[model samples]
Target: MEDRELLDQLFSGGDASASAWRAFLQKYSNLFLKIIWQFEKDRDEVMEKYVSVCSRLMGNDFAVLRKFPKELGLKSSDFPSWLVAVVRNISVDLHRHSQGRRRYPKALLRLDPIDRKIFDLYYWQGYSLEEIGHQLDLRKNGKGTDVNESFARILRMLTRYAPRERKATFPTSVPFNENMFVPDEEEPRVDVALFDKWLEGLPAEHRLVVRMRFWEDMSAVRIARILKIVPQHRVYAILQKSLQKLRTHVERNMASN
Candidate 1:
């Protein structure tokens, strides 16, 4: 059956359609597993959290699920993409709660949840604005969403005063890793190997540019120069496509592993 038809059936209060949704979830169960795998916690905790996120979405109103495609401007062909976005958003929230409680200096401990995440992404992850933009798939002309607005918020938070920075009590990198960069404190470890395996079947150019830019750290200018191709502003689109593929890839790999 078509997605819109299935959605119409679901939203119209067909109770038996619950199984249809269940089948949809089952079809994409790997996506949920990938989000949980990102947490990289204990196996049991991982399973529990994975199930929790799924249960939340499963019980979510059918109207809510139906709204996603429309709200995101996703096409019927883009159903999987929309599905993965929902899964990732849930996973990020789980990581936020987990990080907030980790052992830290009293000053650092006082930072708000969002601030901690921004700080983590900036200092710990070492992601540049462009890279962060690429990860979130932000683009110029406000492609779907405004890039400038999101980063402006991020910069404001990053520069926001934290008590720890004020106190000079922030631990140095070596000791900091022990305290702040704890693996379990973040999301589960992504299975890069399994993710790569899923992408092995994708088109070569798609896979190559992605591997070059992200995994190999080649800049778009460099990628264009290397590939002897004209550079366009749509590097983000290329990267976004690759990452989306990996996102789904990660989702599938997480479940299997």
Candidate 2:
């Protein structure tokens, strides 16, 4: 069945919904297991996390499943990637729950300036590896650490941030490689009303990039295509420009106080 058709079947009530639920489980169960296993290598724990994920999906009559990006021009081809992202989130949460205690605010406060910047990029920028590589220049340092090793260490540092709400830092590209990335485990709520205030003052394109990329949690590439901005880099450019203004505004307020 087509992706949209499958969603319609699942979302609609009655016998069709039940059948679609089975089809969904049959289709994506393995994928869910794969993601869960990333957080835990033990088969028993993996199964436990997998069951937890399914329960969450089935909760409130499949509330999580209903959050499909259907309104974002979802295509059948895009379904698996979207599903993977969602599953990854659930798995990460399970992992964090096992890890015990949320200390993101404290952890963030303890980071050295350099490490803090790295966390910001990973957390807020949705930075692709290359962009982060450029910013941190992990390519080849005198230290004798390999690039992947260095980046992995940085990502390990990131596990501290605990995945509060991921403010939409729309990425410069595909963001991180999901196979290896460990995103925020959980995050405390942040009142971004101030940021939203600045957001309202942005130009149309800037506002769209910010709102779609960050607020809506849409991918940068997807936003580019949706906006029909050629070369895709234009989306990044506009986003960066918008962000600089917001940052400056925040800095100004802080300095005034």
Model 2 C-alpha lDDT per residue in residues 123-217, reported as the tens digit of each score:
44446456665655444344322335444544433221222333323223323443323344445333365556667879888887767665554
Summing lDDT over every window of 10 consecutive residues in candidate 1, give the lowest-scoring window: 169-178
Model 2 local distance difference test score: 0.63
Clashes of each: 6, 8
* CA-lDDT, candidates in order: 0.54, 0.63
TM-score of 1: 0.40
| Model 1 stretches astray by more than 4 angstroms | 97-229, 232-257
Tens-place lDDT per residue, model 1, 1-257, is 67666666666666757767766666777777876887656778778778777666757675447666567556787766777787777777776875644223232233433334333444344455566555544453445333355445433322222233332222221112222333425442333445457469678876776566544445566666677755553554665565456456554544575
Worst 10 residues of 2 by lDDT: 158-167
User: What TM-score quantifies how close candidate 2 is to the native fold?
Assistant: 0.40
Clashing pairs in 2: 162-186, 163-184, 163-185, 163-186, 163-187, 164-186, 164-187, 168-214
